[model samples]
Target: MPENGRTDTGPTAEPMIRLEQLTKRYPGQDRPAVDRLDLDVPPGEIVVLLGPSGCGKTTTMKLINRLIEPTSGTILLDGEDVTRADPDALRRRIGYAIQQTGLFPHRSVADNVATVPRMLGWDRKRVAGRVDELLTLVGLDPDTYRGRLPRQLSGGQQQRVGVARALGADPEVMLMDEPFGAIDPLTRETLQNEFLRIQSELGKTIVFVTHDIDEAVKMGDRIAIFNAGSGIEQYDTPERILTEPATPFVSEFVGSGAAIKRLTLSRVGDVPVPDWPSIGQDTHRDERAAAVRAGAREFLPLLDADRRPLGWVPADASGDVLDRGLPIVTRIGPGDSLFAALDAMLAANSSAVVVVDDAGAYRGVLDLETILSTVHTDAGPAVPRPGTVATPGTV
Candidate 1:
């Protein structure tokens, strides 16, 4: 709760990155790009710098890596004073990814990802292994993409390569400046989710820069909302920022859709999944029909022998259920956000979405009503209905 927005990580644990009175001034500029600002980034947590253009959010991030030298201030990395450290050596310890991807057009994907490792004097075998490891880590197949140039890949692929390159040496800290900004919305969302999944495994200390509020909400463990002159208007969790605006600028910037934005904070797993009428694929035609009729549901969810959803069969379907009705095209996992669940429902034009586990096993069904009830209520776990047991996978 400190004004500087330092996360409380106990007395013994120091911040991974700390900026004290950080200031940067450009030549011929009347005002400093970054004023005397202070912030702290805890280990293994993402701290987002969010603001409008020219608000100095990017400048503050650049100053940390010495991409833009601070005119006056202190930069500390893992309790070491690195303000005057060798820029090259300092950068090698911190990964950097930017909006444009910045991959060499002629360089093969493997070579691009191996940049830092090669520079650090890693042997061919070591560098090669690292390249393949990171490429796979970022969802690119090393065997296929190793020899392909940046131009050979799609925009999303290029961005993935860029990320792989940034993580070339397995740095403990990563600085991402609008890394997904240039991609299309769908691809951007995918990359965001992928990166978040990666972060969960790697647990790297990250400084993420973005002008988009929704991205900040989704990606940031803590967001530092900046104003002109690099002044931090508010620094808090996304839930706090949305529910309790510290200032008028914060309120206006968050806009009037705060309720809708809160959906990003709750994951599908956190909500109670209600039981729906389901029939196994092996069921006989007469039994299936009887079950659907007795259940009185409009659609019957058909599950394979492994309890994995195959599709939904309409109530009036005849003969083989597998041959009829709509395929389960859109599905959500427990890790997905409620907003994503809602999106899946709308995209599939269905009233409910099939919930699957990590192994694609059927968990339960999430309907529109459950989502709305969560939104209007206190955001706690929903009450399980009578006769329905609430397992880890269900309400």
Candidate 2:
């Protein structure tokens, strides 16, 4: 590992982005905003520049796309020196999104999304098709939202449109500067999930900037925790940053409650799914009662004919099991993080939550006890590092 904790992938694998002694100093300023920094961002991964306010994370992002000229140093994109490339051309190849959304007030959503393709001189037919495709990709209905102005949309909607616009020409790389920071908490979370889904599909190389540690942990494949002068305190995966802080600054900046934060690193699918007693919604009363008596569970999961969970039924209850059972207000999928499973349980005030597949078919069950056990396992809370040996009792 490099002194900054950044893994060197060696000469055979060229990074999508490489910064060698990159520095940005402004006139009349005593110190440089971004001190000489060396960093590498592999292709098809999200590398987050995380730090406190004014730590130059944003500046580093801007430097990547030449939004601001660097005082001196090399900026390589796909092994080509782009430090002195045409600013406009370089930016066109890099998608950029900021906290403000930055959509044109006078333009319609479709028109805004078409900005890059239009600039690239794509014909109207192709541009229009790309706009519609991108709108739908970002969860906006083209027919309903295409003609609407930026002012007419909600904050979350505007951000979605902004993202659509950033991806206008299908750039290989994207720069996001706290894109969801201005939205409401619930909406912010929804957008974050949506973006992650999109990234999984597109696999775009991304450099995301944020001061929020939780956001960094959730979004980044690797995080560069910056201190003042753009110094990288720790450049490693979120699991390592939380489990093994490189410096006192990183430990303090990561803050307390690391055990809880580690939960985000694991997904529901990573844990063993426990089988729970279940009954079909249409089972006869006698049959249901007999099955309940046969099992030791107090409550049995109720499933529809299609095998999707409906609710939980008290095993001893009489009459129709479906009508008397408690409704399942929340259901999670394999892709959801264990943190999300825990949240679902807490939000529904239940000790267990239903797990489903992509088609919403019943998979198994995740209970509070399983989550606790996973957290307190001998292997330590989070997943083991790539090459590290686990202890004898470790999971």
Candidate 3:
């Protein structure tokens, strides 16, 4: 594997991929396609290159694998200089997926995915096993689709095959150029989500090129906005880029609704959901009476034996227990975007949404006021239940 390790990155302590003073100019062109570009892609992170057409984003990507030779500069993968390495060999070490997919109509899906592994001289059993494994990884049913030709699959399926093929060799880095751009919006979103789930699991160092801001925001750990000279207009997280754009060009490119885009960065886990007044299902009558009289809550959350909330008991209702205030239907988990929580609230026409853990155990209630307070200031911590109000933690 070419002694891939960086002392700075533990045993592998340097940038997974580094481009320094990279420049590319066509023979007769007045300007370089990528002029003196410099970029460092750290291991286990997705760095998105986003810009307008003709802004050198794709050129910069191609330079890394030497798909197009740089006019002058250096390419380093895992800290070893690759400027002098064989282009084809360097490329094989880096997985590349493109918008067109480039699958072979003549080849079956499994064979297409096996391309890289086969080239690497794996035994037939290993190549076949890897092909099936990769096909399954990208959500294709190997048993059903393995032998099917690429033309027989739908566009989305073809794209999946492209991704699986790219991953067949399990390369440390992936270069994806608008790989989802051709799919319909709904399918595109589904594929994007699936990619995210896969990326989170695989943690491959990736350079994703896209012209769409929303897709960049959704996919990138850090986004680099490029200019004609390959200069970075802004390089930061989606939150900083949206909330505090570095330049007018960026603000314009990010488009309107900075506030709405901010919602994407804010997760339900990060909002401050205040503790509510609650009583156990077997609480004493006097205790229940005191809770209703105190009026600290609109409804006392009723807890079961396991500390999970049953339903709301209206504070104004008579007796220890009354008719269920409302069924606990929709819930927002920690990983969900605040935008989703707000949507759930609006859909239910409720002031607050229930937050729950993965097991469906109630955590707390997130209200509009708390969400606004945190988001408007842009300083909220994740799932802060302030004021030490003694929450049951499971409701």
Question: TM-score per candidate, in order?
Answer: 0.84, 0.87, 0.84
Per-residue lDDT of 325 in model 2: 68
Comparing candidate 2 with candidate 3, which one achieves the higher TM-score?
2
Q: TM-score: which is higher, 1 or 2?
A: 2
lDDT of each: 0.84, 0.84, 0.78
Worst 10 residues of 1 by lDDT: 383-392
Count of steric clashes across candidates, in order? 0, 0, 9
| Residue 305 in candidate 1, Cα distance off native in Å | 4.0
Candidate 3 residue 329 C-alpha distance from true site, Å: 4.9
In model 1, the runs with Cα more than 4 Å from the true position are 1-3, 7-12, 275-304, 310-329, 379-395
In terms of lDDT, model 3 sits at 0.78
- Residue clash pairs of candidate 2: none
Model 2, backbone clash pairs (residues 3+ apart or across chains), number:
0
**Which pairs clash inside model 3?**
6-12, 6-13, 8-13, 9-12, 9-13, 269-383, 270-382, 362-394, 362-395
lDDT of 2 by residue, 1-395 (tens): 32352465323467899999999999999999988888989888889999999999999999999888999999999899999889899999999999999999999999999999999999999999999999999999999999999999999999999999999999999999999999999899878877877887898889999999999988888899998757899898888788888888889999997778888777776788877878887887677777777887667777889998887777667765546467787888766667878999999988888888877788888999999998777464445221122111111
lDDT of 3 by residue, 314-351 (tens): 65666435534446657777777777778888998888
Q: What C-alpha root-mean-square deviation, in Å, does candidate 2 show against the real structure?
A: 5.6
The parts of candidate 2 lying over 4 Å away from their true place are: 1-5, 8-12, 280-296, 315-323, 378-395
